[model samples]
Target: MAKEKIVLAYSGGLDTSIILKWLKETYDAEIIAFTADIGQKDELDGLEAKALATGASKVYIDDLRDEFAKDFIYPMFQAGAQYEGQYLLGTSIARPLIAKRMVEIARAEGATAIAHGATGKGNDQVRFELAAAALAPEIAVIAPWRLPEFREEFPGRAEMIAFAEKHGIPVTASAAKPYSTDRNLLHISYESGVLEDPWFDASDAESKGMYLLSVDPEDAPDQAEMIELEFAQGDVVAINGKELSPLEVMEQLNELGGKHGIGRVDMVENRFVGMKSRGVYETPGGAILFAAHRKMESLTLDREVMNLRDSLITRYSTLVYNGFWFAPERLALQALVTESQRNVSGTVRLKLYKGNVIAAGVKSPVSLYNPEIATMEADPTQAYDQGDATGFIRLNALRLKVNSGVEQNQK
Candidate 1:
């Protein structure tokens, strides 16, 4: 009989690395390590060799940066999705893509079950399982952190560190660096460690180790930098009049915005697990992109359509944050958000400086902002009707008038 094979979403981190070896020794099953490349530059270097040495039979490295930014990030940006008005869903947005690929590899490798290192308390376990359920329902999921024996074997990071040290697993976790971090092209998230205390203000918040994707606002260039961004059907297609692919556009914006210190957010937000957690995020490119995208909508999108999207942003953000990215409801909302951006073809000039993305100017071919007709300083009778205001105002005020009359009669 063929040896049972299990594929794991391997980050080559301390937890996953230990799990890889544990899976091989305990079950005597073949272990395949799969790493999704969503722009963790230095993190992926030497990962394959490390995984193989640590007990993985086969290793798969996928460069998902372009797909991540374009397919997942861009569409979420189209919806202006922000969980609790602070989190850009950086980690939330990347989870589904990684989970989907893991499922595919499981089928290709003929694996009996898939595994992840997500802790029992986190949202990632829910995300990985939900995406797997949506994409490949047949594959069994083996979450070691959720397993009784696994939890007993390694109760905390200290035991896991001892396991790695005893086995020579080339572990990276240390007592000094106790924080858990997750990184992608979109952002880097740091949790636990010194951050467990809600009031611990990150030291040197500007040039500090906290923000990787942004420069210090104090260190930002003295002069504001301007760049023109082009969009079509809600996807950014160019920067500074140079046409480029969606991926290239983000790459450029990331560099540009980072240099100017454009995006950095620190907030205490309500997590889906019914707890308030403090987090800091650096989304330099996303911040600039959202600023430009909303400016474009002001020009091209219809009032009702924009209002509908505005009302639904919270729901969309919740879906992403709660790990329901692959749900039909999310897809349905994306369809409507994309439909609303059909006429959102335009260019916006933005000046970035001191953590600010200022809309210097904007223009769209389908712009509803007609300066000639909207001018209050001058007269344009073709579109403006002075005579229509009498009934319009009276009809709108009727409810207020009736309420006042009723109150007077009671008095």
Candidate 2:
């Protein structure tokens, strides 16, 4: 029998580094390290050499930042799928894209199985596996964190450190930090460790550093700034009179909005894996884009269509959060959601100031708000009959009136 090749999603972090060493020992498998650079900022330094030196047969570092912004981030912005109405779906959205790329790399490398460092207790495991099943079902999945033998062998951080030392794998082990964080261009999320203590207050600047996306609101510039966004079918096309690529547009927003401290959110949310997790997030660029896109939708989206889509947004958001993104129901709902967003084209102006995104104004050729039909002031030629409302109201009230009358008669 021959050993199978397993390509592990590697991040040069403590967990993935240990997993790389462990896989080589346990499975005797040819381990290929795949690192996707979806806007990790500077955390990607020396990852390729690190993976190879740590016993990987080969290493791949793919630049997926542009694709991440254009495909995953923009479509999510189009749907306005904020998890629990506060989270920008940062970690959630990143999962599918990374997993998709993982499958692509696996096919390229001729690996039979894929592995990731996501814990069974978190939502990420479901996300990684669901995406794998959707894109490449025939490929096997190797989840060390879930395996009884691995969990028993390396029960804690101390044992992992011991394993690394024994294998002569170079690693840095400071006392574990108070919180866990994930970062990308769209947003950064922090939770776990001391954050698990419900009553603990997170410092404005977390222990890792100030939030990746913003400065403190008090430190923002004194002057307000305004920008205009042009939309075509619910996606941002131009910024402040200049057209930009999707990644470029988001990058611009990050600069403009972060300087003003426009996006910070803290909340305790119900995780899909059945636990409540408290997270603090910075989504400066995404927040600005969301506010602008929604303002445009207000102008161009039809009343009934808008209402219907609004009804599904929460459900759609839940599906994404729960890792059901590759399911048939999600596809069906997305089709309907995208169909409604097609007419949502126009321009929106916004003011950024001290963490607030104020909708300055909006305009669209398809606007459904007609002043002539809705104005309270008299228009002599108005075709609307005010008299009809008297009957309409009476009819709506009839059931309540009848029920009360019966009660009074009985009394």
Candidate 3:
């Protein structure tokens, strides 16, 4: 009889590398390692060789960068989704895409089970398993960190390192500097280690070395840089008047935003699994895109429509944070969000300085702003009549007048 096959989401990282070897030894299963390339850049280099050397029977590295930007990232941005008003949902948004591809691979390879390296305590596990259950109900899901046997064998990173040495798996991990990190095109996040302390100033020398995407605000250049972004139906179509693909747009903005020290955040966020985790993130490109998108909306969207969409931001953001990307409610909400963007086409000018994205100007051909009604200067035959304010104010003040009379009577 052939051994049971399992597909493991491999990242060429310490935890996933160790999990690859452990799965082979414990289950005696044929491991098909898979890595999703969602703009991790050079991290994907030579990963196939490493997977094969680490006991994988087959290896796959899929480039999902364009899909990630076009499908996942843009839609979330269009909804103005932000977790806790700080995080851009960088790692939160990537998990569903990775899990979706893992399901596809599992079906193609005739694999019976799918595995991931997310620990039992974190939100990634929920995101991965929920997506797998929704997408492929028949396939079994394996999580080693939740098993007592696995935890007993390798209690921590130190033990995992020893196990890796015994298995002859090459790893650059060590007990020192055990800061956990997750990286992609949108952002790079650092947690655990020194960052676990909420009060630990990340700007200090010891913690500062962990940042990879952007420079420190103090080290940024003295002058600010201005750029223009063009949008069509709520999506950024061009930067500085140059049309580019979604991936190219993100790349360009990341370079420009990182140079100006934009998009750095530190906060204690509530995880889906009922814990508060301290995290430091650098989301240079995403910050710029978000600011520019909102500026464009201010010019094109109606006041009430924009307010209604804003009211749903918390719910929308929670759905993304809790791994409900495939849920029915999220789909319904996304339909409304898409409808709200129907006329959100415009240009926004912005200035990027040290740790700031400032809006300079915004304009749209479909803008509702009327200078004739807005101008304070008197016009001989203008439509506006100053006499109309008397009735408007009196009608609006009726409720307040009645409330004041009632309060006086009570006193």
**What overall lDDT goes with each candidate model?**
0.88, 0.86, 0.92
Candidate 2's residue-wise lDDT over 1-411, tens digit each?
666789999988889999999999899999999988988878899999999999999998888888988878887777778877888888888898889988888898888999999998999999999999999999999999999999999899899999888887778767555567788888888887777876776655444264667877777888889899999888888998999999899889999888998788888999988888888888899999988888888878888888888888898888888877777888898788789888888889998998889989998888877777677988555766788899999999999999999999999
RMSD to native for every prediction? Answer: 1.6, 2.0, 1.5
Return the TM-score for each candidate structure.
0.96, 0.94, 0.96
Worst 10 residues of 2 by lDDT: 201-210
Candidate 3 clash pair list: none
**Model 3 lDDT tens row, 59-163:** 999999999999999999999999999999999999999999999999999999999999999999999998899899999999999999999998987899898
Q: Give the alpha carbon lDDT tens digit for every residue of 1-411 in model 1.
A: 778999999998889999999999998999999999998889898999999999999999999888998899999999999888778899999999999999889999999889999988778888889889999999999999999999999988789999998888997765666567788877777787777776777646532766677788888999998899998988889888889977777778888888988777777777776777777777888888888999999999999999999999999999999889989999999999989989999899988988899889999888899887788766565687767899999999999999999999998
State which candidate, 2 or 3, has the greater TM-score.
3
Candidate 3's TM-score? 0.96
Error of 2 at 52 (Å): 0.6
Please give the lDDT score at residue 355 for candidate 1. 83
After TM-score superposition, what is the CA distance of residue 52 in candidate 1 from its true location, in Å?
Answer: 0.6
Error of 1 at 124 (Å): 1.0
